[model samples]
Target: MLRLRRPNASLVLRALLVVVLAATSAAANEAEKAPPDLARGARLYSDNCGRCHNARGPAEYSDAHWPLIVTHMRVIAGLPGEQARTIEAFLRASNNPPPPPRRLGRLAAVVPAAGLSGSELIERYGCRGCHVIGDAGGSIGPSLRGLFERRQADWIRVQIQTPREHNAKTLMPLYGLSDAETSAILEALRAAR
Candidate 1:
């Protein structure tokens, strides 16, 4: 009688290892080929980081330091490897955003923040870049439809000046705006529809 021979354990084990390695390499290659989506990363960062404390500013850490920070947070926050890498990319990208129009010259960095109306202040600072102040703006942040009604004046003021004080971590850039600028921004937000 002819008998069927069983496959050798060593050969099976080697083949399994090869398959596993090939799969792993393919996954790594795919990840490398795909570009990190900054918008998705930003959303992920907002969702994950906000769950704990607050969002952190991209400029808070240097490019060299961002990887380490993201890795640590990834572990603590239990974020996936791909997501953590995306966040790192977003942070690094944000840390070095494109340059604005040089036509504004030296004074562009620090608008006088005086004699400007609330709406003017908002426009000057590009508040609409991240928040939907009224009918139009980016969707990155919450809509500033009813600011004063929702939050105390002091709280709003603090948020404008230093967001970290409230949430401990946030990607909101500190504009170092003066009292007048902050007040103007607060008023504009209050008047937002």
Candidate 2:
């Protein structure tokens, strides 16, 4: 027969309370710690997205409005799901309007030589860095504003095929282009005038 001295209810209660308090405090501390992947998230937003929209700034709309804007741009801009997400992250970081898609179209070849559009050539080799045409580009190279009027298609073709051969000191990089790309750029240049 066990004679239990009056239960030490106070001691048992105190021990339970200590355990509960310790667990709660630990959880709170963890919640207060820094968030993971903050730097990675920022880099991902910039490399794939900053060109099209501002990151982490004032947006014209509320958070609820962003999804609709993203949807429209993804389809119209031909962005893949991952790219769209990158753009979304950038826009969410700073509320900014997404850039519009560049306008491009193939020009009909008037002369016998087959070709790609001037716009296509520009986009393919990124010619905007060295040239400017009206409001379109920069000054890395000579302004080709009226290249069509100033140059012949055959001359342009030769230049595309081997720029250094024509001018050793030319700042233009040798694009190591195929005959087809040369023809296309020439055709587009001819059409530009």
Best by lDDT: 1
lDDT of 1 by residue, 117-165 (tens): 8787776555665566788665557777776678888998888877778
RMSD of each: 9.2, 18.6
Error (Å) of candidate 2 at residue 162 is: 0.7
Q: 72-191 in candidate 2: lDDT tens per residue? A: 867866666554554454345333323422323343223224345555765545555345644554443567768877777677777776676788655454545565556566655555
Q: Specify the poorest-scoring 10-residue window by lDDT in model 2.
A: 103-112
* Top-TM-score structure, candidate number: 1
List candidate 1 stretches off by more than 4 Å.
1-18, 97-142, 146-170, 173-193
Cα error, candidate 2, residue 171 (Å): 1.1
**Residue pairs with clashing backbones, model 2:** 56-93, 56-94, 57-94, 59-95, 116-184, 130-141
